[model samples]
Target: MTSSTSSSSAPEPIWAVLGASGFIGSSLQAVLARAGITVRFVKAPRLSARSTDPAGILAEAAELHDIRQDLAGDLAGADVVINAAGLATPAGADSPELRGANALLPVVVADAADAAGARRFLHLSSAAVQGHRPVLDESTDVEPFSAYSRSKALGEAALGARKAGACPVTCLRATSVQGAARQTTASLVRIASTPLASVAGRGDSPSAVSSVDALCAFVLAAGRYPGEVPAVILQPWEGATVASVLLAAGGRKPLRLPGWLCRAGLKAGYALSGLLGERLHGTLRRVEMMWFGQRQEPGWAEATANVPEPRVEQVLRAARQQR
Candidate 1:
């Protein structure tokens, strides 16, 4: 499933992408190449791996404003800087490393983008910042609960606090993104393939998902947009409902979970969360999302109205194939 989004009207911007080897980041690079855009890849050192200079890496990251590694020289030629770096596994164990990657890294990167005279700095944030909130948008108040959500929210807030610059910053709060590279998407599809999986409210709720391709399309258009985009943009929804997506991936509809049963499960899930913390809470958030699904602002899609329409069905097909 590919998108042909070429436009001769607006000049394409040179891209500098951090974390270019990660799933989303790598996928984005493919999309950019397909569209004939010039890009610079700046891969960050892996913090999760055993490293000899872990302290040096941590110090160079923006633990504090004074110590942020100056990256302007690396980003000098780029017109747009896309920050695809950060800890992707939000459910992992908490530590200073996690917080620094998710929370402090953006501050350093944004400062560098400004110094480099880039036109924009696009930060990849997560919808997890909203936690299990029923509805969400760029303007909605944050309700971060888990260690990961809190860290992501903190990054957004830290970036938000900076004074406006010619090189503006935009944080993209991506939703439940899926692709062939993500094991999590494969796992979800595998679960839905089984008879044990069930959905809430007859599975009519929005899936709150956008394919990696669609997300890349959004970034492609938004990055070079001739006008102003919001400081924070929710990943644009592409009209795939939970039931439909599951059916696409599994070849059968997920069993319907009744409202009463759903409510009881959530109650029990929350009660158990006190002891289990992230492990139990992660499951609870998934349940809440399946039932309520979060609402988002439509302005993002409207702003990029001419961008190629997303093929979410193909995304599910790929997930099914991978699973």
Candidate 2:
């Protein structure tokens, strides 16, 4: 943990973040460190894929118990527990890893946070909860289609199922978070930067993409929030549209395509994905997001605007630097 305190009587709030080595978690940790906050990182086990085998279940259970016990001790002086661990690779959705990190691990982390009497537990969830929503909100219910989304939804449900306890819980439904360490963002920028343009749904749909900087702002604001935060908060859109992304990437305007053509393409893609199962599910969702986009109404970010986010161009430039 980085000690950012003086001999002053009032000490700064300490943070204990799981998956601190992860792309998003590490970025947030850096921001927290720069802010002179004490942030301790607890490592979670990367267990093998789960199966129907009873032995696998029992083994996983034992591991979870051990992690919970160990983490409680590590969280001694931590005021907030941020769960940024999870299997994010859409390709690995069908694997058992998703269930462990995304589904089972959150509940266990929450347990440890509660056991340690942490002031807050911020769960890093995904907007993938509702795959193709016109507008995503805190009140949005889980209607996941792919394994990755399902696992995330399951985690949220499990946490909700638990009895209300000491720790105040908040779930951050991150929308298309991108960072320099993310290969996904690199690929996306390459595609978007191509001297081609794509305009769909009247060319007003939000890009549905956000940066690590913005996410960091949200995390800090939520972490240091004075009052009780909402149980669920969607990432506030920063007004980046598909056209804007393309303009930033390639410095050109795109041709407008009919919304019906986009919808038709989506229908066919979904039908093929359904026949194949799971593999293309997340990809199709991303495609839909690119075409139709998703809207996030002003909420928590607006309520707690303590932290400042970098400009969209700065964020995209960082993504461009990604290998």
Candidate 3:
């Protein structure tokens, strides 16, 4: 569906969403539009199809240059600003761009928002920040493991460093987010379509996932009800294993591969695919490692139960339609 604004009695607040072209950002755009709020998307470099989808809208509004650049004009009368950009490169990977995007950019965004006189600034974060903490919450000590986790933690720190009450910042650490056409979930679907779908091992990890619609709902609610809801964790109802999600997406039962065996298989698959000039190996292997490496926590499950359920059938039906 195309993005639109809902009609409200009083003039809706002008909202600026950074990274509006990303998976969660795009969804937030649609949610805000439906709330009757007129959105002024601020992206890195404006694109032609800014309002195409949630992500497209954000991409179209990006500043293009460093975020530290003046946004006083851009954010002139914005009532709220939401930063929902992140990166998830594998460990030991060389990713200067990823670091800048995930770690550094948030600081710049915060600075800009402060200068713009925005009353509320919401920072979208990852649940990975909880790291191996058995039980995570706002009070739990943060212990990030992977580069992605570290980046998110750093972003949160930056948000915190900002003088308190200076545009009350709310940090939301979200679990694995799922939706109809997100790259992450699409990759999971692609891996499920392979012959080696049965390679997943020991799928007892209690991981949480959030649907795209639910994520958007949270973002809009945050924008609409800032301070009223300071910060919270968000996850899907009934945490599922990688294997279960694959099965739900129509893949056969995954083969359980031991750690050593899975590593060997990945190496072999990469070598063979390189020789055959085909992309056979699954990219989700990295994700699987992240999921398995970290200790499971129940924070997301506890928090998400309070939030409303998303239209899962609608999302699934949309995926089917695309197929």
Candidate 4:
């Protein structure tokens, strides 16, 4: 989605979204378009799809040089550049290639944004970078264990190193994301659809999910936020736990497994997968995130008044609405 209807009081901001075909980017584009904003789809060659470009503005590139050369016009014209591109477990987390893409691409995008004279750069980071913090905040030192978490932490650090550049930067560290095509939402739907579902593990840890709408809203607000805003921002509100979210989504209470047993299985499975190079039901990263509760400060300065407290019901409703 690239230009917007500017009023006398507020001018619309042009946005260049890297990874425009991904879940977050596509959702953000939809939100921006609804608000009459213009969006530029800065896409990677491997993942670029013509169908994803409703705006018909496609800038395709693969490498760092390719990004700069191909999206030069989009970047130069944009007021906000959002680096929503990254590889995760859902995409492909098996190799060094995905890790490198997640870790290094944000830095490249930030450099391009700086050179292009963009006003603000927002990179979508993850809360897992905080490791096993009981309460996550902006001040928490990153303690990443897994490769995915390390890459995200490194990406944030990369952006921080370039804060003095032409464009001001911020990293929006989202909790687990739910709503629409998101894996979490899909899991919920699957559980709900099943008459009797085997929900593994004791779901005591908080999910700290941000509904796609709420997340998109927060991202939009952060992009347009004043210069006084901090470099890192957490999702607003303390989010729901996995159990509560699942129940709220109308899934029956899962047949519970003992917490200790669950932990043992998770550790054993993760270790086996790593040692044998075998595909497992879930990655170590996913299991760790699920077991380690994500609790954050109540109010996020990055959130606007209009950004609703994300709810599990909202995700269920959004799923139904989309269908």
Candidate 5:
């Protein structure tokens, strides 16, 4: 996506997006560009080193900032601020960097928004906060299972507390977000690409899944909505399973592994990743936890009813182009 100066008459709102290089963040950049919105992206320096490709890393770094030492000062002229930074950790692993980014970043974002005199602060949260419930809504109590979820919950509370009477704050709780393959969803796609991934033993319950376009649209809509509450959840449509998405993406003949076998395979993969001191295969374990551990499904019709329908095919095509 190309970036350009905002028009004087239009006064294109300056959107400061944290984590602008991530799967959601990158897609947001493209979507915002298509919508004619001028945005400035900010990202932590250390995190950029984890990228696999040099070109990708440099491309992301060009529009990012190292938010480690000073965050408020970096977000000076933002009219709207969206924090899409967070960690996707395995169940048992404890990464200090992930913890800080997921738990402490909201406070930083709120402080930066306050300093920048931003009209709205949008914090991207996870649906994992709903725990193992069968269905989740805006009123559902948060019961996080892993460190990532716990940290997100903490950050949400921090943002809420800091948003008392200043700029409005909106905490978006998104469901299983699928789009361009990334460190989080890459393994799942790879496994599905293999001949053995299936839903034989997996639960067939209706789950909530949001496409990348839908997610960006929700963020844009929430930023424009006039409301009194400081927090808002962006749940998507239910009945969207991993199997369904794979089928929709043109998977010819998918395999169906028993649930027990799927779990065991994931356990073995994580063990191997831990032994090798790498992150390549552990992503499978994280996806398994998200699919099985969380039973809650979000309702998104209310938030997205007015928004335009997301071009799922275009999103899938973008993923393929990246590959």
Candidate 6:
């Protein structure tokens, strides 16, 4: 369950992961390497998280001016191509860069991968596609309420629309991802480092989370997945809430506001942002996600891939220690 090693005798896969330096992409490379898979990176200049690349087991790396360029010849040997490049932050949604990464990027990669004769394509999407829901699953209709979520939904749809004859594609819709390098974890580290911090709302709203370990496991499963393509909303079987995670991260109770008051305040804040021609950079959307997040079951991946119970608390503990 911890490692994504396939039991089948199938030969190791040749993987070409786009955006190899971001939180998910970076972690994915390490996981695949640990599994002894042959993996390479296609580092888009616009996509890398770090200004300088980190040393790793990338067999080869490329800087492409356009993701849609002819890659079939160079990538002919790749078994699968993973579009792990994405905009993870709220501010990224409002920025002009989103159209390329969150909307146009995946489709371009899918088309290029298909042309490159990759057998399969796996895309990394977010559970934010659900916006604010009570219970979530793969079949739940996504109702994105914010720019970030909307972009993710659009990316899914774009990838979903590929020509039927192309490479088989699967989307891994994950919950709030927590890892050492992830933006969310970094934000929590800053909050925990602060001597005084206050959490908003009742601090008990249920929010699904995916540890980097779990998310990476799901991705690896998708590469070797033999069953029909399924909508996999990856999360622990047990549920956790925003307050619990915050407390676990910082080890201090955050200032709480009434649930109703929090919602009202968010609405007011949104209105003021419009009036002042200001942008909160999806802060209100994030608050809404925390206040009204959904609970989901792993379902398909659990039954087929045997994904593990994500150690959510462990992920938080690691972040705190790093702080």
Candidate with best TM-score: 2
Write model 6 residue lDDT over 192-300, tens digit each, in one string: 5455344455666666755888778778877876766663344444356776776777777666656777768778988886665436636666555545555665577
lDDT of 2: 0.75
Candidate 5 segments whose C-alpha is farther than 4 A from its true place = 1-3, 6-8, 43-70, 90-92, 181-183, 200-204, 228-230, 253-323
lDDT of 4 at 60: 21
What are the per-residue Cα lDDT tens digits for candidate 5 across 68-127?
235656677777888987775535444546545665556556655776677888888887
The 10-residue segment of model 6 with minimum total lDDT is 51-60
Clash pairs, candidate 5, are 201-259
Stretches > 4 Å off in candidate 2? 1-10, 47-63, 304-310, 321-323
TM-score per prediction, in order, is 0.87, 0.89, 0.70, 0.77, 0.71, 0.79
Assess candidate 5 and give its TM-score to the true structure: 0.71
Question: What do the candidate models score in CA lDDT, each in turn?
Answer: 0.75, 0.75, 0.58, 0.65, 0.60, 0.65
**What value does the lDDT take at residue 323 in candidate 2?**
33
Model 3: weakest 10-residue lDDT segment is 45-54
For each of the candidates, the C-alpha root-mean-square deviation to the true structure, in angstroms, is: 5.2, 3.3, 7.9, 6.8, 7.8, 7.5
Superposition error at 71 for model 2 (Å)? 1.6
Q: Which one wins by lDDT: 3 or 5? A: 5
Estimate the overall C-alpha local distance difference test score of candidate 4: 0.65
How do the residues 1-323 of candidate 1 rate in per-residue lDDT, one tens digit apiece? 12233556776557899888788988998888787776688755333212113243334443444333447777887888999999876566666677677766776788888888998899999989887677767774798867778778877877786656678899988888888778767876787789856777778777786688888988888887878878988887778787877787677888888878988988887887767766677667766765656666676756658344776768878878866
Model 3, 1-323: lDDT tens digits are 12246556787788888777778888878778877888887764222221212233234225444435555567668898877765554343324455456555665566677777888777788776766565556643588655556656755665565455466667777666668877666655665567655533576554354477876776666566523554545443444555555455544566666767656766676677556533332243344442342334444334433454555434533453454
- Candidate achieving higher lDDT, 1 or 4: 1
List pairs with backbone clashes in candidate 1.
none
Candidate 6, residue 42: the lDDT equals 75
The superposed Cα distance between candidate 3 and the true structure at residue 91, in angstroms, equals: 6.3
Model 3 scores a TM of 0.70
Candidate 4: which stretches are off by over 4 Å?
Answer: 1-11, 45-70, 90-96, 192-205, 277-292, 302-307, 317-323
